[model samples]
Structure formats: C-alpha cells, structure tokens
Target: MATPTIKALSAVIFALSSNAMATELRIDNVKLYQPAEQMFSAPTSIYIEHGNIVKLLPSTHKQKVADHVIDAKGQFAVAGLMDLHVHLGSSGSNYTNFQYLPVEAHFNANLYLGVTDIVDLFSFDNVLTEAKQLQQTQTSPNLFYAGTLFTNPGGHGTQFGGKAYVINQDSDIEALWQQHLATNPHVTKAVIESFGGMGNTLTDTQLAELGKRSKAANLPYFVHVSTLADGKRAIKAGASALAHGINGEDIDAEFIELMLSHNVTYIPTLAVYHNHASESEHQQISHQTELLPVLHKKLQGCLFDKVPEPNVWFKTMWQKRAHAYQNIVKLHKAGVTIATGSDAGNPYTLHGIGLHNEIDALAMAGLANGEIINAATINGATTLAVDDKQGQLAQGYKANFILLNENPLQNINALHHINAVYKEGVKINREQLAERNQIIQPVGQECNANITSQTAQAVIDNFNDKNQWLTVSDSAMGGGSATELVLKDKVLTVKTSLGKPTHFGAWAGTEIRFKQPNDASNFDGVALTYKGSKAPFTLSIYHSEVQDWDHFSKMLPASEDWTTVKVPFSEFKQFGFGNKVQWSAKSITGLNFVWRSMPGTPPPVPNNEFHLKSIGYF
Candidate 1:
C-alpha cells in the first residue's frame, strides 16, 4: 500500500477543522484509518461540533467539553466516500431533474452509503451548487459537480437529453466550456466519442488546445471515451482521466503503457456493462439471486415506463453492458489508479442502491475488500477532488460514517448489514435507509454465491481461450511460398519460405493465394499465435476496404516466445485483398500463414523470413 501524501493529510485536516466556530461533539473509541498517508490507531477521539471537526483529541479529553458524545466502541470509522461519476437528478428521461431528487433524500442517500461528497456529472447540475449552498444553510451532503458532457455534432451521447449532448462540430466547444464554468459546476466534462465507434474522433491538436485552455481555466477536463480509435485518440490527447476502460478495445501492454505514461486514472463502470452481459446468455442476469425480487420491484417503480414499451433498449442496454473484471486485477497489480462509479439512471440500475452493486461487482472483479473499499472511498474522493474532506477517518474530517452489523471488508455482501448512518452530528438509524435501500438480499441459496479471486481468474482464463483460432491469408504468387513453422535450435520461429510481394498488389494472379474471410463465422473471433524474431518488429494487417488509414489496418503485437492472443470478432472487414478463405474445412487445417507487413521495404532480402504456427480459436 502506497502511503498517502502529506498534502492529502493537510487537506483532510483542513476540511475537518474549517468550521471551527460550529458546536462541539466528541466521538471516541474507534479504529481510524486516515488513508491520507499515515495509519493512526489508538483510542482516538474526534471533537466535532455543528457539522465540522473542531479537534481530534485523546478519549481522555472528551470529559472536558461537548454537547453530545457518541461512543464508537472500536467501530471502524473511516472518512466518507466520494462518488465522482454519480448520476444525480435522474429519471427515465435522458436527463434527470433535481425536482425529483430532493435535497434531504439525496443527502440521506449519500450518508447511507458513507459517501459524504459527490460529483453529479449530469444535466440539471445546478442542483449540486444548490446542495453545496444547502450544506451551509441546511444540513446536506457536500456536493460538487460538472454541468454536462460536451460532445461533437451527432457525437456519442446525442440522445441523452437535459443539456446538449450533441455539440455540432461547427459550434465553438471551448465557448460552451467557458459557459459551463460560468455556471460553477466545478469541473468541465467533455466527450471524445470515437468516430463511427471505430476511431477516436478528436484530434491531438484539438486535445492539446483544449487541455491548455482547461488547465488555464483551472478546471480538470474529464473525458468519456471508449475503445479502439476513440480511446487511442483521447489518451494520446492528454486526458485527466478516462471515464471507462478501453470499452471496445482489447487490453494490451502498449495501451497500458500509454495510460501509465499519461497518468490516466480509470473509473471502470464494470457493473453497468457486466450487469447485462456474462459468459452465457443465461448468466446475463442473476436469475437465481434474491436481488431479482428487489430489483424487479425497484424496476417497477423506477422510470420503467420511461423506457419505450416496444423498444428493446432495455435488452440492448444489458447486451452492450458486458465486461469482465479481469482488467481490474491486471490494472491493480500494474499500479493503475482504479476508482469506483455506478453509471446509474440507465434501467434496472438506480442511484444510491446502485453503488452497492458496484461494490459487489468489485468483489466479482477480484478486488479484495480492502482494495474495493479504498477504490470506492479514498480513490473515489481523489477522482472527484474531494479527498481533502471525505474518504478517511481522522481528526478533522467530516463526521459522515456508517456502522454495519457485519464487516463489509470481510464479505462484501455484508454491505447490507447497515446498522447506523451518521450525517455530520445526526444519526439516521438503519431502518430509515432500508425502507428505500432497494438492495435485494440473497435468500435460501446465495444466487450471489461468493466466487473468490481464484475462481474468477480460472473462469476468465478459460473464457479467453474459448473458440480460439489462427487465420491464414492467401499468399500472393510472386516468389512467396508457405511452409510449416519450425524451431531453429529450440527457438520456435517462422520463415517466409516462398512468397514476397514484389509490388504492393495481390498474389500475382490469386490462384496460389490464401486468405482471411470476413464472414459471420469469422466474427466473435479467435486468437492467432506466431513467434516473432524479436521485439521492435511490426506485424500489420491490411485490406483495400480499409479507407481510414488509422483504423484501416490492425497490427499484431510483437512477442518473443510463441504467444496466443484473442482477437474480437468485430475486427474483420470486407476488404478486397485476401483471395482464399477456405470455410469448407470447418476448421483451420493445414493453413499456411502468409504475409508480413514488412518494416522498411528494403531487404532482409526484401520481406524477409515468415513462419507459420498454430492458431487457437476462441
């Protein structure tokens, strides 16, 4: 565990002690983890009066002065959580209005989940400002938010009503950003939706210019980009954080390095996606869980009517919302910043209760209770710029805490054991929260059977290797010939025994050519494995139909040893290049690996050695 910085400590202390003039109440006998940098454990006492921490003293000092005293009695009291990507003021409409989300209820919702501060990056965001003011006038949750997502003309979130989701390319986006700041949403939310969901639509120059302006304006510019070209483009654009993991893109080392270099923080809304899709169609929903009953009831009352009666939007929403937490384990181990957020307000997924599901998903994602808690707590605060106050338990932080009958850190499901919730100095008993918790508990059998990290890894690994394949293309005639892969002195390698593209045209006449077919069978794909000479080599695939150069072609990563990789089915194209696709075989048999997108077209006897190897289908 990395130590929290001194700056983080100072921020928490500042937030706690800021309201020094408030009344005083002492809370003692709790184990505190002020994760701002240090670990303090003792019979610590917090002196909070009127919604703010007045001082942190030893329990012995509690007798000196205080209006009310709460005996923590060894309860694990940590700072409140911060949810950066929350959907506030929600309904069935593309936008949610604050009218439906009352201040009292909204504040109570945060208190229920131990989330003291929040950032509602949605339409009708003025409510956040009001909430902040309410915190001063009336007791409410500390809230900060972004007005709305700025996007391109007909870009990503066009149907999302409320504020303008579609920013016509012709309109001045910077001007719109300026207008947003004027409204005081705190942060400026921007969109870099991939063009046609194939490539990042934003240009580097545009990003640099926008980045400069956002920095100058002293606003953190958060981007909502997904997979393939869009993700590649936006990360290269220098972003503060990526709203989602490479949603439509495959996870690879190169992309990971890019994110690391840019220091891009990731808020993987895995629940939003996985809540719908799973290993099999039957596994998509928790068909056996007790949550189904609660979820069904919640769905009944939710803007279920808001979804079109005949539309398959709900179905489609789940289908597209497929994700595996394998990436979380990978990133966590890789030292990537992974935070928490529930992309709620969609369907079935609601606010308040939605976060618990997110926590559940984290457990399924293989994150330990400690990591998951920190991700949702401290890490979340960092994402929302509220770490100074929330996300820890210390002397000066706000007195937003929860007491559960069971330790959620031990079993994430224990999150349901909510015993008590405190907002500032007032205690809202668990009963108040349960009536609206909407969280379904597992009954007789745990539909939500706890699958530990070991099991999850095995499942994920098996899923990756399912339906594997090795696609071989037609070799252009010329001198290009094909042969079986061989191991030269124990080192497995491939040699281009026969063919070479003299010019960049088709295999001389096409008769001797082999190919990769773009057909339904080829979709939902498989992986290709081949050993390369060494690193620093380029493996490229191309087709004439690939009009967009950036997205036109794809490349295979260079690996030292023979490696198997899974390629998503959507990558194949209707390009007029490869001539031989032998589907009749029903399987890749005796297929000759042809062609290598050569690096400098010079020698290696021009288009050097190419080898053929086994391909796994998944």
Candidate 2:
C-alpha cells in the first residue's frame, strides 16, 4: 500500500480532535442558578453532551461516567449573560484609540466578560452577516441582528450611515416590507422619537403597518422611545418591546397599565445614560487585560482626569440618568418584564463590560441581586424569543454558563469574579481569544515610511497621486449618500449623490489621511484649487486632539469656475460638540473637502460633481 499522505494524516487528526470535543463533559460539585426559579440549587453534577445539558445529577450520585470531568469545588454556575442592545461594528466609544479595531475584537471582549450572546439592534447588513458567519469558525457570542432600522426620512436612525429604510407619506409600505424581509432580520426595529427636535419620526399609521408586517412574519417588533408618550404610542401601535428606558418623563400608572395590556417588554439600557453621567465604573475597569492596549491607554488617560465644568450637554445627560433610574424602579415594581440592554458602542459604554455596569446600575435602581441576574439572562433571552433553548442552567438547554468564584444571588458584583466561562459545553480559551483580537492598525499607516519632512510650502497633494485619496459618504454613518473619486490628467474628480439628509444633513466628500502625524505649525493655512457644484462645500481639518465628528472646519465658496481659495488657520472653528481648544496644528492627521446640506435644504438631486487640481499649505 502507498504511504499515507500528509493531507490525509491532517484530516485524521482533525477528525479525532472533533470527536474528542464532542464527547460528554461532566462538571461536578457546582451550585447552579435556576433562572426560572430565581434561586440557586444544591451542589450538582451537570452532564453535558453534544453542546447541550443532558442531565443534572446529585453530587453524591454513584454513577459518574463521562469522557471528561471537572471538579468545580462548589463554585457557582449560572447561565452566561446576554446583552440585547449592541453595535458590534463600533468599539463602544469613538473617542478611544481602539475605535478602529475590527468587529472580532468586540466579540472576543464579550466572550471574555462571559456574555454568551448579543443582539445588535441596528447595523449595516454586511456587518451583521459577517459577524454571523464568524460564529461558525470562532468562539464567539451568539449574535442576533435587526438588519435595518425602519424610520422616517431624516429620522434618528438615519443619522448613522448605513442604509436605514426611510418611510415617507408616499412610500409603498408593502414594497418596503418585502425589501426589509429580504434582509432576513431576526427582529424588526423602528424609531419613534422626535429626538428633542433633532429629526422627524415615523407616524403611528406607518408604525402599525410595519408592526403588522413583522407579526405576519413571526418577528418581534421593538421600538426606540425615550418619552412616556412615545412608549404609549408604540404599544398602541403593536410594539412587542420598548427598546429603551423612558427618560423624557417619569412613567406613570397609566403607561404601566397600557404596557401590561399590550404585553410589551421593556429593555432599559440604563448603563448608557449612567455612563454619560459618571465615568467611575469605566475608570475602575480601564486597566483590564481584556481591553486592547490602545483603548486601555486612552481610557486610563481620560477616565481619571479631574472632572470638567458641566456643560449643557453634561447637565442634560445627568438629568436623563436620574430619570432612567427612577423609571426602571417604577416599572419593575409594576411587574413589567425588564430586560438588560447596555446600549454598548455609545460614547462610554464598553461592550462586554457594559453589561456588568448595567447590572450594577440595576442594583442601584433598587432591583434585588436575583432580579438583576434574571433581567440579564432570561429576560434578555425572552426578548430575543430564544428562552426555550438559552438563558437557563437546566437540562435540555444549551450548556452555556459562567462558573463564578462566588454566588451572585447573594452579591451581584460576584458575577465579576469569573473563575471560568463555558459556551456550548466547551471552556473558552480566553488568552487565545485576546490574541486573535489584536487591534487593527489605522488606515494609511503602511505609507508612513514614504512620508517626507514638511515645511511651510510643502505640498500635501497635487491630484496626481490617486492612491492618497479616499472617497467618503454619509453611508459611513448610516446616511443614504454615495461618493466616487476618479483621478485623470493630474486632476481629481469627485462624483457624489448627497442622498437623503438626516438631522445632521447629508455629506459626501474626499479625504487624504496622513500616514504619520504632520506638524504644520510653520504654515499659515491651506490653499486648494477647486471647482464644484453650486452647493456649499467645507474644508475640515483633523488632528490628534479631536476624536469625535466635530472637527474644525472652514466654509469654502461654491464656484462654477476653478478658483484658488486660501483659508487662514485662524478661520477654522469647531463644529458639533467637540471641546474648544487652542489651535496647535502640531499633530495634523488628515483633511476633508465635503458637500453638506443643512436640515431644511431641498432633497438632493443626483449626479453632482466636483474637481480638485491641487492642495497644499502656504
């Protein structure tokens, strides 16, 4: 016979490994938390087979046959936690250095914190699909997503860049529903808030129509509402769940009765509000090993700094935090089904750790430790419509649980004392997970070696090297915009569709990022040759001190004929909520030229074009 080949030998080894992993695993001498009963049971031996709990034997039982056995020594075992509101595409905060980390890092962070499952309320379709596929090849949390957020044109959901299904008075509801169905979403989400006059919202008729379609397809309809009025309207319009805690006002008995009558679940994402009000919890976990190194450094630097003077936004956030806490207590006392959703990927809410902060917030809101655990587990599973097989530590359920050093029922913070974590009967290799989730280098870093020293007259771009330019559109934030860049004859042309503007309006632009930070202090300002559409354009400057979207920008005159515009550095002003700081121009990162429309601007027309011949500092 011929000698066995290397490929065949490798295949045989893989098969043997698979068989070994599939063998029965017995966890002995562990106290299990029974979610259904809201209590812990006596020490027991859990027999797991094929990734499901097959039996729960008494610790002293005579029969103990299994392929693998772990002596737990009386550790507490509970169903792995679940975070229902997350945006896996984001790194929790845009201000952090790790904002650009790949989505896999978020998954690994969740698993490290013992979150066995997550539900992404809104994200781009491709991102959700890619995350779903990663589940098969890696040790990741079970991911469920609501592919597209159904909102009105220029609504709250549309403010983020992906394509939100925008409903207008003339829209074909049935056609839109068919398109939404094509995305194969696990849940249907809609925005019903006016967002404090920031944008328009879906009408009751449109919401009811969408809810009817969702029910027809056997999917739960969840609505994002901040006010008690919107909460009532959502339930009346057939919402299966309210996606956030009511913060615009205190929830009263009437609203509670209405919710009870409609059997709507309440997902109070209190951690997000609490994070805005105080960064104490975030500061405590800034040094965690599970966090990527860059993010860890950024957090440590900012979280412990002396508190700044309270601004209007800060005061508003504190009020909302108080309202959210009070409202959750009222809702829980009224017997409402309160689920935990951390709203991770917001400003300060870290993904995996956000859930723990949410639980702590729930406890601070007067929920008992057992009630908080129930909210973190079974209630979240119920909201996802997966409680039948998940969110419980019992026979006939998936063997997904966390082994804790102490019982959480007695002290909720004990949940943080994780001894080991298991998902689908297999122990997680946390060190491997961290290694696989290393932070991704920022875009354009590879060209750093090619960067030359800059002087006052140094050229940034001459439109001849197309490789240095990148096209950007509103889609990056979830708007309906599109952009394309073409370079020819030493001139760069930008083709753009402004798309539908959100509350922030629509933007399409071209950007050139520096491979390394540039010190442009010697230069007075930038001079660029450009000719574009009649719509106004902006020249935005990015630097190390500004992390959010509120970069310093100066408006450029719209010109039908090519003109050289010189903008002095003194003219640039901070836009949006960025902190006011002195201009240094010492660590410039990039520059952007964009066409933007304000809220009242007419709906955009197609096929807009612009051209840039040269760009440099004078």
Candidate 3:
C-alpha cells in the first residue's frame, strides 16, 4: 500500500502552537478518505496553506486561529474528482458558440459537481490556449488538453472543424511531429474510426510512427477507437491508451491480456450510450435546474431535450451497450485499470453532473464503491499522466477537494450530494461563481445589425458566361486540391485533381454566389445539368441562418454520362456545416459542387472529375 507523502511537517507545529499564518485555511471535524488504507479516518482537522495540504490533526485538537475556516461538521471529505475524458468544446453544435462560451459557466459547472480537474481530449488551439490561462485563477478546475487531433483526411475529427492535423502519407509524419512539439500538448490524439473503410484509418506504420514520436517527446499517445478491430489495431500500433471502450463485441481473454500487457487504461464512457439507449434515463439524471443561475442557457436547453428521438441506430446501440457493459466488467475483474469518463458534451452528457451518471453506470457494471471512487480520483489522474500532482488527498497534494453531505463509501451516488468544493485551499461560492457569468453592455453603441455583405439571389448561368462561375477547394485550409472552370468550344468544364493531401480531404469545386440572400420558401428545390464519370460528388446548398457551416449535402447518383438531377429541398438534411437551428425555407445562401471524402465514404484519394452546365431552382 502506498502512503501519503508528508509535505510540510513544520506547518503542524505552527498549527498546534496557535501561530498559524494569516494565509492558512483550515477544515475541522471532517472524516477524510485515506487512500492507502482504502477507508475513512475518524474526524480530523486539516490545515492548508499556499494551496497545499499542510497538516492533519485529531478531532479533539483545538481549532487554531486561521484566516479562514470551514466546519465540515463530520461530513465526508475526499480528494477532488477528476474527469478523465471531457471536451469543454466538443464535436457538436455546442461548439458553434464555443468561442462565446462564458468561461465562468464552464468552470462553475465542474466545480459545482465536485470535478476539480478535467482532461480535455480535444479542443481548438485557441480555446486550449485560453483555457491554460484561465485555470490559474484558483476558481476553475485544472485543465489538460491534447490541443489538436491528427486524423486521416476526412476522418471523424475533420467533420467538427476543430484544429485537425491531417496525415495523408507516411511522409507527413515529420511535419506532424514538429507540429505536436510546437504545441506541447499534454497528450497526442489520433483517430481510428470504425464506421468508415480502411482508407479512413491510419496505416500501422503511421500509428507506430506517431507512437515513436510521442515517446521521444515524452508525451502520451491516446487513440480513439470505435470497434474491436480498431482497438486492436491501435494497440498493435503502440497506443498508450484507449480513449473509448469498444462497442458491439464481447471482450475476449486474448484482448484483455493485450490491454493488460500494454498497461493501457480504458475510459469507458458508458453514459454516451445511455443517452442513446434510454431517454427516460437521461431525464432522470439531467438535474440541471439544481445548478441554478449559473447554468448556461445552452446546457439548460440540453437538460430539457437530452437526446434525439430514438432511431434504429439508437435501438442497435442499446443492444450493443449491454455487450459493452459486460466487457467492462470482465476487464475490471481481470485487474485492468478502468476509469470513469462520461464523454460529456457529446449530446446528453452534461459537464460536471453527467460524470455522476458515469459512476452509477460503472457501479451497475460491478465496480465496488471504493473502486468507483478510485477510478474517478486516482485512476483518472493516472490515465492523464498527472497522478503525481493531483488526484489524491495527501501532504504535497494540491488542496483541491470536496466535502460531501453523505458518505460515498456507503453509496457511490453520495458523490452527487456535494456540500462544498475547495480549490487551492479556498472555498468557492456556487452562487457568486454563477453570477460572474452574467454579461453587461458592450463598449460600442447599438446599430451593429446594419452591416451586410454582398449577399443576394444568384442568376443561373448555362456555361455561356465565364464570370458566373468561381472555383473553391480545400486548399484554403491546408487541404490539397484544385478545381478550375475552363470554357472551350462553348462548353464549361470543371477540371479537378487531388493536389497534395488534406487534413480534411482533397477536392476542388465551384459555387454560384447568390446576388442576394434568397428565400428558399419561394422555390421547391434545385435542378442542375451535370455530367461526370460514374464516381460520386457532393452537391450542397447553403443558407445563412446556420451557426456554423449551414448546408445540406447529397451524393450525386452514380453516372458516366450527362444526367439531369433534380433534388427537392425536403430531401436535403441540414448539417452543422452551414446553419444551426433556423432551418426553415426562410433564408438560403448559395450552392456548392464538390467531389470529396465525406464521413462514411472511402478515404479521399488522388483522382476524381466532374462537369456542369446549368443550375436553377423551380
């Protein structure tokens, strides 16, 4: 058993002698969790100074004079919990306002739930940079970020539009390594998606090279996997950890052994599936109103509508969830390290409170109360490679902890009953923390809405006019591809080629800029005359009301000759690429034609072509 390392024995004498410094903060009459003993000690008085635990005295010890003191009144005290997998800015629409997300709101939510530290698996560089500064204020939880993700062209990470380092060939490795070194991220992330074909995956050589670079840099290499095969491939490629548990399959002994031998920690975010499997369960756990004035409006909205209406995929995931739960139990019994991760901010997984749901799910999966506590606390720190600095209650550990109204040792759900939270030895006011999020007026006056750009309805051109067409490609954002419009012999040709390689995907295409924003309600759909090889290309119509990229995409039916395609607006499913919520026939922006790699298709390779004649809507 490991013992707590005493950090300041001199503080004990200062505390008992009535000479405690004005900077000291003390908590009295608290039953504290002793990690080495794996049990709670009798009521003790703890003295803290300079954000570190300084001394522990018996319950009978006289209260020393201190600048600040909290009477625990026999309440249970435990080391602050750590969320191993979290995304303050995530892969969904919530990120549409990521830049505007009130930092106070984000931090308060975690503090209120007793999660004093978070390992942000993925975030834009700017967001991570800003967060690094915010965590130093002694109010917010400590943040550790992977900074950016290196993914296959058009792989899962690219769809979110976060900072993605694209790796298309083995030669791209050196540049990626340099980029990782420049950022100095806490971990290096790579994606191995299961829904797509092998093209979307990194070759074994690539994964191994990433591992090599990460090891050379002394950074942990964490891989995101979805299926059993993806997990196996990632591990074989030298991944240090599995970002998520494999779904849709049982954990065989061989696989368990593989994980054990590699010393990989499994962060099974079961709460992600719980939201898909049962809405009522989400409703039961989504106690956002309890958070009161500080809860962000967006999070409040999520509380009300936790998940999309259950679809066929939901039903399928529900069945697979059972298999996943059993596999987790097997891994735990085999002495494999399992940590609690909610994948918060995904859909129904709310930050802070959602982690409690994860703990409950782990409990149901056969983890004892002590094991669940360890997973959330020490094990979580271990997973993020920060165990030495955070996660345990001991001398030398940062004085970040939570006082609970009930004993979590008796019932894991007692974690939800937070009495108070402390960061750096200072108690946080939940109400004041929420109040700081309120906004006042801006420095400038009103009338900002009058600014407008060159937005108008487009006039259809039949390839007879050269100025009517403009070409756009992924090259603008580090993608390799060029599409050009050529007019010869009274024919308009769209010539495209895979340029170098892209972080997103490689493709070139053209769009007809609308003269002014048009109302989609005035028209039913679009009709276009296009001719190309049997290969497919994407046709998207853009609208302005979206928060992010607001557009609807459809694959052009396979064709080898000229074909007239008419698609109704109803057939188009809106995505984050264009607009957010205002998805009505109210405002339409423009249209795009591109041959590129989408989410579930083959990886974007080097050759594709298309030609267009006219575009119009009836």
Candidate 4:
C-alpha cells in the first residue's frame, strides 16, 4: 500500500455522523480480498476523492481527516458485486415499470448494496440514455442499460413491461440495426421469454446485421435466451451474451460446444431461479447463508394484515428450480463464461439480496471462487465494454474492490462476509453498505414501522376510523420491515440495506375495500408525499383488479423534493369486484397501485410498491 496524502475515516465513525458529508472516502486497516486472483493482501489504506477511488495507500502512514473513513479491522474488502439482469424501472413481474429510481436514489441504493455497477436489462432508450449520463458523471454505480429489448413484433418484453418499443420485422435488418443503435444503448436484447424461454430466433440476416452493426457502432448485443433453442440462436446470431442461463430444459453437450465456440457470455440470474426453485437443497442453502436474515425478513412482511399464501410463488419457485442449473455446472467446467445475474426486482427477488443470492447460486454451480469473482467483476465489465477501467486490481484500473472477512478462494461463501467495498478509491464500510443495499423483502417478511408524518397521518386516519379500508401491492413487496418505514416531517424514505445496487425498488400503496353495506362509493381522490428521482418519475393509482393488465388512470407528475399531489376522484373507477354491486366490481377484490416511467409509459394496472400518505374522499 502506498502512503496517503491525508488520513482516513472509519465505519464506526461514519455510522455515528448526524449527516453524510458526501465526499472524500478513506478506509484503513483492511485486508484487501482480490477475488480475481484468489488472494488476500495484508493491511492497506485506501484513499478516495469524490466518490471515485483515487489511490490505494499504505496503512502505515498516519491517516488524515477525510469526509468519510471506514475502519475495516478483522475484515476483508473486495469489489462491489454486480448484477447483470436486474430490473428497477418497473415493479414486480407485472411491469408497472415504476421501480426505476430518481438517478440519485438509484445510485444511493446501489452504493449501499455493494453493487458498484448495474445493467438494467430492459429499460427504454430515453430512460437508459439518461442513466448512462448519470453513470458518466459518476452519480450512480457504473451503469450499462439496454434501451429496450427487441422481440418478434408482438413478443415478450414488448407487451409485458410497457417499455419503449419499435417494431422491426426480422426481415428488415438495416432498419433493425438503425433503431437499436439510435437509443445509444449499452446493449440490445431479443425477448426469448416469448417462445416459452426457448427463444424466437431472429433470421440469419437479422442476426448478421446485429453482429455487423453493433460491432460497427462498438455497442454489443445481448439476448434473454433462457432455453436451448435461444442459446443456439444467440450463438448463430453472434449475440455477445445471454441473460439468465439456460433454464427449465436440459442443455446438450452439443449446446455447450456451441456456446464456447461463439464466446457468448451467459448470465444465469440464479437468484430469481432460486426464489422459484422447488428443491429442498437449494432452499436450505439459500436459507442458511448470510442472505437468509434479510431474505426471510422481507418475505415475512408480504402479509398486508396477515393475508395467507402471498409470496408462496417465491417458495414454490425455489423448490421447482432445483435442477435448472445442472447444465450450467457442465458449462463452468467446459470453460464457458457463466456470469453472475440477480434479475433483481422480479416478482420474487429484490436488489441487494439478489446479488447475494446470485453468489450463493454460483457456488452451487461448482464454480471456482476465483471464477465467480471474475464473473461479477471482469466478466460483467467485459460484457459492458468498460473492461479498460472497471475490473481488476491494476494501478490504473478504477479503484473498485471488496474486502472480505475470509478468503473467497477457500470458500465461495466468503463473498457475503463483506468487510468493505471500494469504488474508485473510496472505501465504503461493509455494514453501512449492507444496511443500504437491501432493496425489497419477501411477501411475509417484517417491515419498517416508520412512515413519513404525512403518510402516518394517512395510516392513522385509516386506523382510527372504523370504515377506513384499502387494497395494496404485496405487503412484503411493499416494504421489507415495518420498521424501515420512516417519516421525518412529511418526507418518506426507501433506503437500501446494502452498500451498492443490491437493494432498490420497494413501494407501498393502499386500496380501499368497498365494505360499506350500502356499498362504498369510489374514493374521492388520493394524496401522495414523495421524493422523486433526480430527474422526474410518475406515480399512479389504479382502480382495477388486473395488475399491469388493465387500463390505468392518469399519472400524477413528480419533482425532486418531497411534494404532494391530489388525484381527482374522477380518475377513480369501480374495479369489477368490490362492494359496488349493479355497477359494482363482481370479482375484483382489490384496487392496485403502480409507478410509471418518469418520462415514459402510463402503466397498466399493476400492484407495485408505492409509498403513500393518504387516499380517500376529498
């Protein structure tokens, strides 16, 4: 370690500060864990300027007074983990597309989760271009977002997420290439989910055009090929990578032969797979790891008034997804590139925990510890075309690494025992980072009891009154622990539990139960107090039962600070199932909520997490 110009601050001290100063990060007394090399260096001090890492100095020098200093005694530090297939622009599988954060919020969430980099796999051109700007400015984790996926005209990502879209028949190779590159996206995707995960192969001309054009533009292409058919096409089309490893079906040795032949990277979002796996071993291992405390706590909070069987799909997936990765292991040994992917913000997986779960699943895949680290660090960086400065521990490489408590080379689980995470040169305290990285919780997990004063007022209004009633997104999906809810004055907060991009996208909204014997009339309106994204975002109220499947009311616009909006009751409708008989909803029991693209779609009715202050008759 080289000598530092000044001293560094420690985690214990940073945790005690009344407010974060937001610059100058220094870390000392840390054993750096280099996963790529499978080695741990002795004690060293790291110096950070702004948020980027500036230098790695020796701990022998007396530390200086930096803005933030994290003490990493008896701990290890490594690069912040990266999730390749994470989703934040939308909420749940319904694709209300609301979880995308204000740039600052997203950055802070990723930082806490120890996610130094992220690839929002399915964002739109406008949304992604903006995020790329933030990344360049270093406002958030190094970001790489594909503007939107390209499925067959009516394929999967097109209708599912309400993301930006342009139809290109596989026949129009030139038009296809032009449209994809127009977004200035990080990567383009082919929605394989449309073909039941087997994948709808774009024609040879289309594939050849993609290879040529992307290569010409210096922008690589990625595909969501979750099956053998898709895997084969990605190879034939020369796709740079595949999101989510081959799942649900067996991979023939011939397919493995093909992947290695094309050098196409495979990102198995193992965490999403684990959440949906049905096998006991996978479940037990997932539960036994350090991620268990956070994962279980989140799932437990899914109950809105103890509703039964919510988030059951998560457990069921975990059980059924057991054998899904057998082929991935063969690939690992076959010298195929199987990178880490969390597919965070899906129905069962959130952010920070998603990375942890991915690491765990990778371990189950029989990967060498060094290989897993490479997958998250170098491999992901390679796919993003930022390898020049993102991965590795070379002097000129951006100062990004994680300090582990144990040698990951010895046991892959050591990745979870994070002591510190350094981005650029600034070293973040592991504990502080973990607290912020936690994004979403499971369906029945506990939740923060905190609520903003305005939101509290709403909760109280409903609580004290006998007739106050409402419906909401999945409770556990809404907020992790009741305790996480915080309201100072009227501004509400949704913070990450990890130090990077691990945790993000949990919102809460309420729907009123039309229990009035006379049948409750429509709500007069809804009130919201929120801190919008760095740019702007949309908040919407849906009066329908179909989550992300029905027409939605107008979206209330947003701003940077805590602001309020009152949606008109005219915007409300009788969602076919509540107490409004004759004109009443005959079966739809709950009115759902969702968040739309800040400058994008108006979102279909979907039960996404929304932080609310109040909803009622004006």
User: For residue 304, what is the lDDT in candidate 3?
Assistant: 46
- Model 1 over residues 1-618: C-alpha lDDT tens digits? 999899999998876675443346777776555454334356677777666666776665534455567788766655565556666655212111111334445555566656666666665655555666667765455666666666654344443434553444534666776677677766666677543333224456666666666667767667776664555566776666677665433567876777778876787776666443331244423332422322323333232322222123234434443344666677788877777776655433445555666777778768877787788777876665666766766545667776644555556665544555667767755445445434432122222222222111111112122222233322422123343433444233444332432233211110111133222233344456555543223322332122222112234455666677666535533232322222221221121223443312433322234332543345
Model 3: weakest 10-residue lDDT segment is 440-449
RMSD of candidate 3 to the truth, in angstroms, is 8.4
Clash total of candidate 3: 17
TM-score for all predictions?
0.57, 0.77, 0.74, 0.59
TM-score of 2: 0.77
Q: Which of 1 and 4 is ahead in lDDT?
A: 4
Writing each residue's lDDT as its tens digit, candidate 2 over 19-107 gives 66543888899999987678888989999998999999889887456788899999999898999889876666434333344677778
Best by TM-score: 2
Candidate 4 Cα misplacement greater than 4 A, ranges: 1-29, 42-74, 91-106, 129-139, 161-173, 197-201, 276-300, 303-322, 428-618
| Residue 50 displacement (Å), model 3 | 1.4
CA RMSD, predictions in order: 20.2, 8.3, 8.4, 16.6
Best by lDDT: 2
